[model samples]
Target: MIIAQQKPIKEIAAMIADCKKVLLAGCQGCVAVCLAGGDKETEILASALRIMRKLEGNPLEAVTYAATRQCDPEYIVPMDDLVKDVDAVISLACGVGVQYVAERYPDKWVVPALDTKFIGGSTVHGVWEEKCGLCGECILHRTGGICPIIRCSKSILNGPCGGSQYGKCEVSKDVDCAWQLIYDRMKALGRLDKMMEIQMPKDWSKSRDGGPRRAVREDVIIE
Candidate 1:
């Protein structure tokens, strides 16, 4: 899951000050889990924006809506009518959602309400720690499912970097060394020998370097 944190209210307030009408959109996916831009959060932000505008003596019309997903075109279709009437749109979804809205309605101004943080999962309520870096290649199979790209400070694939001490990362004492977890996991599964395998330098083309990556299923396509 991708975790995101909401932007400051003041910054959001500034973005829509010039617009007489604005739409505040939220997502029910990743942002919902992080408690940043869920349906409820969207209403909260709308209400706050209204209050702030009144306080600044520049009251403007604001509306809130939560979509099934901002990433999918089907989910965003419903907002076409609403977006057409608004001067700008403030999306509380991830970065992808903000861009999707802009792409679909190229004329409407779109602003992000949340800062896309990282790909991670919730370990506890309201606590989302990053676990993956989406580095084009996944080595989790041989690393006992722990991702070194996100956990390790340097993203060393082979083994624990010399900087690890007492199971903690040298970059930050609060962070556990990613390679340490990988080492223990491989040892328990009797696959520690796999660590000796060399990995070729990652091909940048597969990542964002070349262009947007896509997945196609020829069998699923029907004319």
Candidate 2:
């Protein structure tokens, strides 16, 4: 899932300082799971904006709405009429959701309300840690399911980098060495021999730096 964090209240205040009317659009998707831009967060932001602007002697209007999923056109379609007259839209979703709204409503000004952080899984309630880089090439099979690219301080391929000390990352003592974890996991599973195998250089072009990536499936395409 995409993890995001809400912008600061003061920063958000500046985005709508000149607008007379604003829409605080929320999504019940990834942003919701991260608790950054859900219905409750939207309401809280709307109220804060209203109060802050009122105190500034230039009161403004802030309307709140929570869509099923801001990334989906079906969920955002109903907002077309709503945006017809608003000054701007503050999307409380990830970058994808923000772009979807912007592309669909080219005439309206749209601003992002959250910072898209990473693709990750929650460790516990309210705590999310990144686990994947989505590099388009996965090596989990040989790496004992541990992602060295994202978890390791240095994205080393074959083994721990020279910076690793005492089975911990040199960059941070709290961080467990990704290669060390992989070694232990693979060894315990009777797959330690896989570690000695030389790994080829990663093809980073498959990831975002190459260009806009796309996946096609003939079975899923409509005529």
Candidate 3:
């Protein structure tokens, strides 16, 4: 899932310093799971902003709403009436959600309330770790399910590199060497021979280097 962290309150307040009214739009998608932007978070932000504005003698009318998903157009349709009277929209979702809201309401001011983190998952209650680089390619089959592209400090396709020591990364003592993990995993699975096969250079054009990317399922599309 896409992870995100909320921006500071002061910074968020500054974005609509002059507006008397604004909408706090939250998404119940990935941000909700990360505890950043969700139904409750939207209300909390709205209340905080209202209190700040009231204390400054510039009272604000902050409206809060949480969409099932801010990324889809169908989910955003419910917000039409709520946005019509608002001066700006503060999106409490990932970068994609922010853009979706902006695109849906072209004339309204749309701002992101969270910093989009990365494609990752939580290891504990509050700890999330990045596991994929989204290189637009999958190489897990060759690496025993460990992703060197992101887990490795250098993104070496075939390496423990010269920097690995005691199964730890050279960049940090706390970090484990990604290649070491790969080797161990392969050995345990009796697939060590897979590591001996040389991997070709990654085609980076499939990644961001090729600019914006899109995925389509022709069968799902309705004419």
RMSD of 1: 1.5
Q: What is candidate 3's lDDT per residue for 1-223, written digit by digit as tens?
A: 9999989999999999989999999999999999899998899999999999999999999999999999898899999999999999999999999999999999999999999999999999999999999999999999999999999999888789999999999999988999999999999999998888876889999989999999999999999
* 10 residues in a row with least lDDT, candidate 2: 153-162
TM for candidate 2 is 0.95
Between prediction 2 and prediction 3, which has the larger lDDT? 3
User: Which residue pairs show collisions in model 2?
Assistant: none
List model 2 lDDT by residue over 1-223, tens digit each.
8999998888888877779999999999989988999999999999999999999998979998898998878899888877888899999989998999999899888999898999998999999999998889998998999999899978878668888888999998989999999999998999998888887889999988799998889998779
lDDT of 3: 0.94
Candidate 1 residue lDDT tens string, 82-183: 898999999999999999999988988899999999999999997889988887877678688998877888877665878899989889999999999888
Per-residue error (Å), model 2, residue 179: 0.5
lDDT of 1 at 82: 88
Poorest 10 consecutive residues by lDDT, candidate 3? 193-202
* CA displacement after TM-score superposition, residue 57 of candidate 2 (Å): 1.6
Q: Evaluate all candidate structures by whole-model CA lDDT and list the values in order.
A: 0.88, 0.90, 0.94
Q: Listing every candidate in turn, what is its Cα RMSD in Å to the true structure after a full C-alpha superposition?
A: 1.5, 1.3, 1.0
